[model samples]
Target: MAFDFDLFVIGGGSGGVRAARTAAATGAKVAVAEESRMGGTCVIRGCVPKKLMVFASEFGAEAALARDYGWSAEPGEFDWKRFQTHLKGELDRLEEVYRSLLKQSDVTIHDSRARVTGPQEVALADGTTVTAKTILVATGGRPVRPDIACSDLGIVSDDIFGLKTLPKSILIIGGGYIACEFACILNGLGVEVTQYYRGAQILRGFDDEARGLVAEAMRERGINLHLGTNIVEMARAEDRWEGPVPTASDAAMSQALKGAASPLARREGGAHRPGEAGPIWVKGTNGQQDVYDQVLFATGRTPNTEGMGLQDVGVKVNRRGAIEVDAYSQTAVPSIYAIGDVTDRIQLTPVAIREGMAFTETVFKNNPTAPDHELVASAVFTQPELGTVGMTEEQAREQEPVEIYCTSFRPMRSAFAGRPDRVLMKLIVSQASQKVLGCQIVAPGAGEMIQLAGIAVKMGATKEDFDRTVAVHPTISEELVTMKTPMRTA
Candidate 1:
């Protein structure tokens, strides 16, 4: 059968865009379809903007710490609307860059939603169809909102970016990274914040010490930590009382200046309205309908497998609707493949991008592609933040004979700032081979630290190597290089 292109990607996210460009650069015809912005979640809503806001919000906390830093400046107010305007402008500029990449590579960029009509053909939202030798579903995952979260208010990571202003007092639900980051962003921005996690702590999958420090730092910041709490039900100011779950409710989520939470709950849902995003009432595990200005379900994500025509082509999806892809990112149907959050395998943006590029190289250029999923670094932008890679002390003990070395101490700067935040560091080393099994950190710039160690852990660094590395005086980072004793031996 004659094909219009060598590769046709169904989503224009990190994975799809990379795959498209890489394949085209290798002289294969490529086309990509996207219903939303060019940069996908990272640039558009998730990482880029989120990190920017994190920096912006940090200014407030730093303002307080400035006095300790021997620099004094009066506290200033934050303009969420203006900040958002700037963020959107920057994002639009980045989108243009992505567009330029596709043009430069001569890859067709179709700004429309796409679905698999069969193994070879993909139908765009505009009813245009394209045929290809291989179809890639880099379709990213969608935010999973709780069954009942808010009525006319509340927000998700996707919706938070478009908010007109920040909430004065925010009640963030779930202990996931998103919830923790939002909590940090808001609290750092001078919002009286509270975080509710059904689990005992935030960043559930992280090491025990990192989780402990993050949780402790969060509590120290007056962001009322509500752990192990269940949702009861939700209520609206106008609506009458009801049973466990209420049908009519309003949810308002605000970030700054303009406050909009589920229908006027905290500090009145004034200026900071949802813009186009509204809130709904949510029933909590407490058996009481809790009404908050902003409610976030950072619980998890579901794949955007619907309306993709994948089912018709026999592309197998898990019960959760995630595309069932193997380590090589191949779907059940050989002609079709999937990557990124769509497959739900270690849902990191970098992972998805790598998988996409690898798939392109292996199939088109005859280059072997298989990524070592181990020793990949990840950071949760919580107050102090948590970064981790490779195995946890718990995970490594089961298989590899290992020794666990860890330390928890107030970061030097925090000691000066009078903030009671502790930086926790740990390394898991295999006793048999003397190779580093894992590395973790709970501190500011943890993302940077973890990535540096990721290379070492991946290359089989030993405890002796870490010990031999010279410590850079008294810095948060020195904790990783200077740990002298083992916390536990297997």
Candidate 2:
């Protein structure tokens, strides 16, 4: 059957872009429709801008240490507006780069919302229909707010990048990487940051020891970390103090400002006035009431599969709205496929790119591929980052007997400067196979250190293999090699 294009990609995210380009490079006709920006979430909203903020925030501590090192360096107030301007410019440049790549790949770009109309037909929001031999869905995910009163008074992680100004004090909700990272970032930027996590500990899936140390360090850094606590109620801080904004809920506010340049929660319902700065009042699980300049909710993310006509066109999605895809990223309908966050397989950007490449290999090159997800190294960019790969000690113990090797001490530089900060290095080894099952590092450069250690773990390197290597003297990572005895076996 004749079609408008060989492939129609529904998202311009990392996965969709990669798939579109690769398929186009195979001499297949390709067209991509992106409702928002070209570079999708990571390039535009998530990782890139967040990392830049992380870098911007860390300078405060760096300046503090400079004084101890005999260098006269004084930390000054952060000019958030200036940094925000530069950040927006950088994202704009990157979006242009993405556009250039798609053009170079000979793929058509559509700046409109698109949905699967039929087995091989795509309907654009502008009332245009395009047919394709195959359709790819990679719309990714969005931040979600929990159900609570006056939640609209809060913002999500995506809104952080779009904030016109940083608040002087913020109440951060949740304990995931997003919450923890931003808690550190905002605190470093001289904001009074209070973090509330209903869970017993933060970074739930990470190694307990590593995350515990992180929690400890965050507290030491004046984060006002609160555990086993959640917001029970919320209200606006008007002179008379009424309930939530009558017009918009926090969820509505998040949705309305999903992709805006500057996202401010404006109340647009009943008695609430739009464009007014409504300070939020909250009551916590522990019976505490306080008003914060900003309330940031990093509770979780949900797949972007709603109102895209997926179900109408016969694509299956789970209750949580994540697309159901096979190992090859193929949907129930052979003419349709999904990847990346929409599929809920792995939410990492790198994983999405890998899935896209694998999809192209299978569909275009006739060489089937499944993206490898084993022993994936990941880092949480909290102050003194946490980096890990392979299994956690708890995970290893659940599977088999494990030997744990761990150390914690003040690093040379921080110690020399009389700072109380300490670094942690830990390795989890399989007792039977003598293989190093996993490694976690908590330090300033743990993210970089874990990348190299991940290679060894991915290769199934054993404890003996690490012992055989010579130490890079006086380096924090040398501990990965020099630790000879297991601290405990379980």
Candidate 3:
């Protein structure tokens, strides 16, 4: 069948762009449509900006630590406006790089939304329809606020990047990495940060010990973290005061009302509007009521498969709105395929790029390829940070007999400064085969450490193999190789 192009990608995200560029390199005509800026979540909003914020937030502590190390250093105030201005410029430059890369590969770019209109056809928001020999969906996902009263008054992870000013106080909802990370970031940035999690522990589904240490570190850093707690009701502080005065049971509410009326909550002109940098009164499930300068909902994220005409064209979508694809990322319709967050398969940016490359290989190079999903290492940028790969100790014990080698202690740097900070290194190993089943580290730069550990684990390195490697002394990671005995065997 004659088509407008060999490939038409619906998203200009990391996955879609990589696929488009790689496919184009194979001498195929490729076109990509992106409604928003290029580079998708990782470059535009998620990783790049958040990491920069993480770096910006850490300087205050770094200056303090420097003073303890006998250096004449004084901590200073953070300038949100100054930092934000630079952040915007960096994102703009990255978006241009993405556009240039696609153009360099001779791929056409459409700055509009697109959706599947038929098996081999796509319709853009501009009322233009194009047919392709293959259709690739990489629309990615978006941060979602919970369905609740006055939830719109709260911001999501995406909105954090665009905040005009840092709030004096913020109530971050949810226990996932996003909530915890922002709680730390804001707290570090000199904001009063309170976190609520309905779950018993934050970072659920991660190693129990690792998450416990992270939660403990969060509390130590002055994040008023509340577990097994959620918001019962919330409204703008002004609206709350329109009713009768609070009773004695509402002492917390009264205190919060006073805070709302404080100069810190009010601006030069007037109090900010609801959903802006305004005071929000929140009633928690635990009977605590308070007003915060900002409320952030990091509840979850959903796939971007809605109104895309996917199902009508025989592309199956799951109940959670994720596109269903086989191991090779091909959908039910052979002519159509999906990858990245839209497929809900390993929602990491690198994983998405890998999937895109695999798709190009299978479709263009005539070499069938499936992106590997096993032992994918990831880091949660909480205060202490968590880097993990492979099975959790809980999961390993349930599947097979395992031995656990674990250790937790204050690192040399933090201990020298007389800080209470402690780091963790744990390994879950198969008892019978002596293979390292999992690796988890909770420390500064654990993200970087895990990438190297992930390589060993991915290569099926056993505990003995690690023992054979000489330990690099005076390092937190040396523990990974030096642990001679199992802390526990199951």
Candidate 4:
């Protein structure tokens, strides 16, 4: 049988792009199809733009700190339009860079959505079919709304980048990092931010003490943090969305009950038409009712494996739409494979790229490599950032006895300014092996620090190794090496 190319990659995300370029280097023909932009999520929407916003949002606090440091400084009004213009330009440049990389590798770029038609065939959104020796599915995921009434009245994280103007006030729903991070970002940018979480704590699944400090920091910064709270009813005012109301999957869910009796109920309009621009009416779980300029939903994300012909072609898809794949990134059908968020593996960009590299090695280089997911480091860009690598204290104790060393205090810089801001540094070590099992830092620049700390943890550095290393004088990170006693043993 003849094929159009040796490989057909269904997404242009970081994972698919890397795999296509690497596989093409092996003297194999490759083609990548993307329905939207060339750089997919990270470069186009998720990390790149979000990080830029994070940086922009921090300037207000930085300026205030400058004043306290004997420098005349004041935070002026933020011009969101100006910042958004620059953000768009930067994203455009990155997309071009991605296209250049693929072109250099001699890989074909199809600007269309694609799906598996058969074991060796793929169908594009344009009604064109292309056959290949192997097909790789790397389409990532998207934010999902909860099954609540008038949910479409709320926007998802992705919609944040596209907003023309920043709202004066917003109600963010969800306790995850996305919701919490945005709550801080918007508050820093001078928006009145109120967060509602259904759970008892925010940033669930993280170290409890670390998240507690983050929540406290958020509250100190004026974020209205509500725990064990959710929206009971919501609707848009009659005069909203002056332009086109949100539609399709973006529309808020409209339930049958309009004038339902509820303690928290407030009705300022007859009905809501998806995508309209009037103020949003809300009834919260605590019997509080009010109007908000915007309501953002960061509840969760789901894999992008639906309606793309996967199940029709006998490819297995889980209930949540994630494609099931082996350690080698191969699917049940020998010629088909999936990786990145589409597989619901690690859901991180770096992890996805690693999986793609491993797939290239196994399939093209004959190296038979599998991605190493252990000790993966990550950061949350909250007001006071959090960086973590390795196991949590709870997880470590469940596996074996462990020793924990931790510290919390106001750092020198903040202390000098008489600010109440404090930072935390923690280390988890195995009692028997004495090896550093995990490290977590909660403070500004924690993300950058974790990258270096992660290298030591990955090498299985023991407590003695850290003790012998000379400490940098007058630094927060020096605490990592200087902690002499286990605060507690688990």
CA lDDT of each prediction against the hidden true structure: 0.77, 0.88, 0.91, 0.87
* lDDT (tens digit, per residue) of candidate 4 on 166-190: 8877889999989998999999999
Q: How high is the lDDT of residue 480 in model 4? A: 91
Q: Summarize candidate 3's per-residue lDDT along 1-490 as a digit string, tens digits.
A: 7999999999998999999999999999999999998999999989999999998889999999999999999887899999999999999999999999999999999999998999999999999999999999999999998888778778899989888778888899999888889998899999888899999999999999999999999999899999999998887665666545343224465575644532223213344443483667788898777878789999989999999999999999999999999999999999999999999988899999999999999999999999999999999998898999999999999999999999999999999999999999999999999999999999999999999999999999999999999999899999999999999998
Query: Which structure among the candidates has the greatest TM-score?
Result: 3
Residue 399, model 4: lDDT of 95
Worst 10 residues of 2 by lDDT: 254-263
List TM-scores for all candidates, in order. 0.90, 0.93, 0.95, 0.93
Better of 2 and 3 by lDDT: 3
Q: Please report the candidate that would top lDDT against the real structure.
A: 3
Q: What ranking emerges by lDDT with the best candidate at the front?
A: 3, 2, 4, 1
* Of 2 and 3, the candidate ranking higher by TM-score: 3
lDDT of 1 at 365: 82
Candidate 2, superposed: residue stretches over 4 Å from native: 239-276
Error of 1 at 363 (Å): 1.0
